[model samples]
Every structure is written in C-alpha cells, then in structure tokens.
Target: MTVRTTARWALLGALALVVTACGGTSGSGGAAAASERQVQVSATFAQGGGGPAYTYDTALVPAGATVEVTSAAADGGTTTTLRVSGLQPNRTYGAHAHTKPCTPAAGADAGPHYQFRPDPVSPSVDPAFANPQNEIWLDVTTDASGAGEATSTVPWTFPPDRRAASVVLHEKATATHAGHAGTAGARPACVTVGF
Candidate 1:
C-alpha cells in the first residue's frame, strides 16, 4: 500500500468537517470535551499481505489513507464509540477492538477480538462469547470523501489489566451465523490503541 501521511492542515480541516457534519462538537470547544476516557490511534495499512491471511490494501480501504480508531469510556453508560477515517469511499469495513497491539512481530500481531470472557479457543467463532455485546464491533461505511465513523457500546468496561490494544479494519461486515460471527474478513490494517 502507498503508506504515507497527509499534511497536518488537511487533518485539521477534515476534523472540522467531521465535527460539523456529525454534530459531535459543542460550541467553540469540540469532541475533545464530550467524553470521559478515550483512546485514539492512527496507522497506514501495509501493502500486500503482511499477515492475518488477507489484507484489504488498495482493493478495500485504499493504501496510505489514514486509519483511525477511537474508543471512549462508557460515560456512566453502556457505550463506546469507535470511529474511522481516511478510507476508500462508499465501502463498508468491519473493525474490532483487539486484545493486542498492532505489530509486525511474528507472535505479537493483533491477537483476536478483545472478549469480555475470552473464548477458550482461538479465532473464536462461538456466537455466545463473540457476539457484539461481548466484544466491540465497529462496521463503517465511508462517504464520498473517504471519511466515516462508527460506534459500539457494551455494558461493561475493559478490564484495567487487559484492555483493547488495537483496532483492526477488515474487508467485510461481521457475520451473524455458524461462521465466525465477529470475524469481518482478512484484516487489512490495524490502529494500535490503548484503553
């Protein structure tokens, strides 16, 4: 993928547009003051299959476009919003809060969706523990300008010792049946976050 960063001004302008369009800001002050705790991460998808079986690359999220993930505290409620931007226009992408950080290390790659009570097995396909209520799932559909946002909320908060460390973008919507219910598709990019 063509991994790189756009100018800071571009980001500021985009953020301004995001706040206004989404009505996420209040008065002169904005989204910065509307939450309790939050984690935001930015990353660029690596071109080609880096790992995780498949990579969306240019075919889905587009190379080099910024991938952002924001996880916020429930704010005395059962809700955590996850947002993404700088993606391919008019396409849907599935994303989840991961148990590990995004890395190229052979053994430390984003490991599984962060489950409230981890499924005893890997690649958890079980509907009971892999459902949206047990894990954070943000499936986003971008606009004409390759910017979008999605939110996910659960009744519980991340365990202090082991919280979601990353957010991985995928090629498809989260499934709802016999297959991996939370598995979006081949992970294309991940945003390393701390929550």
Candidate 2:
C-alpha cells in the first residue's frame, strides 16, 4: 500500500479506539447506572412565643440515589439546609425517623423525640442507651418573614418493581439533642422529592 494510504488507515484505527473508550457520541447508549439528582427543600415558620413554629414547603429525595443534607438551618434561620443519603425508593419514610411519632397537631403536642429504640426493647429506657445513630434531626428556625431552608443527604435506591417513594417534612420540631419527645410538636408542612 502507498505511504499516504497506510497513514490514513492508522489514523482511522486511532479514532475508533478513542470513540470506544469514550462510549461513543450517542450518550444514551452508554452505561445504565443511575445518576444523581439535585433535591432542594425550603421552609417557613409561624411566630410563637419564644421562637417560630416550623413550616416546610416539602421534602425531596430522588430515586436510586443518596442525598447529602448539606445545609439545614443556618445563620439563625436566615438559611437552613439538611442533607441525607442512602434512601430507599417507594417507601414512606417518616420525617422524624424518631423512636416515636411527632404530635399530629400544632401547639398541643411535643410529639416524639428523635430516638431509635434498640431492637426488642422498652420505651422506659433512656434513648441514649438505644440506637442514637438512627435519629435524623432537622434544624428549625426562620426569619421575620418565616422563611428557612432544610437539607439532607440521602442515598436512595429505586425498586425496579414499583414507583419510588418520597421524603416528608413534619410540622413539628424533631427531638432536641437531649432526646426529649412531645416537644418536637406537629407537622406544619411537607414536600415530596422525586426523579
């Protein structure tokens, strides 16, 4: 073969190798692994005697992904963010993820504190003695206009058999760091994260 022809063939072979390594130009034909999605949550609060009652627009979690709760409450309510990761799809995850449920009504119940009882145990025991790592807490604080932000990083996996589930924000305060229930209160607002 002529020198020019040989050079042309070599160039074509090199181009083919590059395309194969990069998964070709058609993006859809590449790997089927799940991609990460951005989820955002914003909230507002109603004025209370000492502070403000927490109210959230909604909570979001994408299917088959983990969300990093980056910023829940910040700057004394001027900014708040929460991050959550490793979430399960299509399941109804309680917002508090506490040992007990939060009070359903505003101003009347403190609801359940953020506690996860050890398996096969009693409520009388101190929450600290139980699984403290299981507790998920949200920062509660709002500006004069009752606006705030909450974020969580959640790693979630989608179930191929069913539609993905959602993350919900409650109206009440989650248990404080001290494990006090019935004070977290009620569900003022909520949001569902998807896709």
Model 1, runs deviating above 4 Å: 1-36, 42-56, 74-78, 104-108
- Could you tell me which 10 consecutive residues in candidate 1 have the lowest summed lDDT? 47-56
- TM-score, structure 2 vs. true: 0.40
**Cα-based lDDT at residue 182, candidate 2:** 24
For all predicted structures, in order, the TM-scores are 0.68, 0.40
lDDT of 2 by residue, 1-195 (tens): 699999999999999899876765455443222232333432222222211122222242222222222222222221114443322223223243332222223321332332332334333134453222333445434333333434433323222332222233444444434344323334442322231
Q: Could you give candidate 1's per-residue lDDT for residues 1-195 as a string of tens digits?
A: 233344666788899899786774354245445445766655555554442222345566555676655566754433555555567778888888888877654213788899988999777988988898888888888898888888888877776687877777888788978666787878767666777
The true-versus-predicted C-alpha distance at residue 58 of model 2, in Å, is: 15
Candidate 1: give the clashing pairs: 1-47
RMSD of 1: 16.6
Query: For every candidate structure, what is the RMSD over all alpha carbons to the true structure, in angstroms?
Result: 16.6, 12.7
Candidate 2, poorest ten consecutive residues by summed lDDT? 71-80
The positional error of residue 85 in candidate 2, measured at the CA in angstroms, is 25
Give me candidate 1's TM-score against the actual structure.
0.68
Each model's lDDT comes to 0.70, 0.34
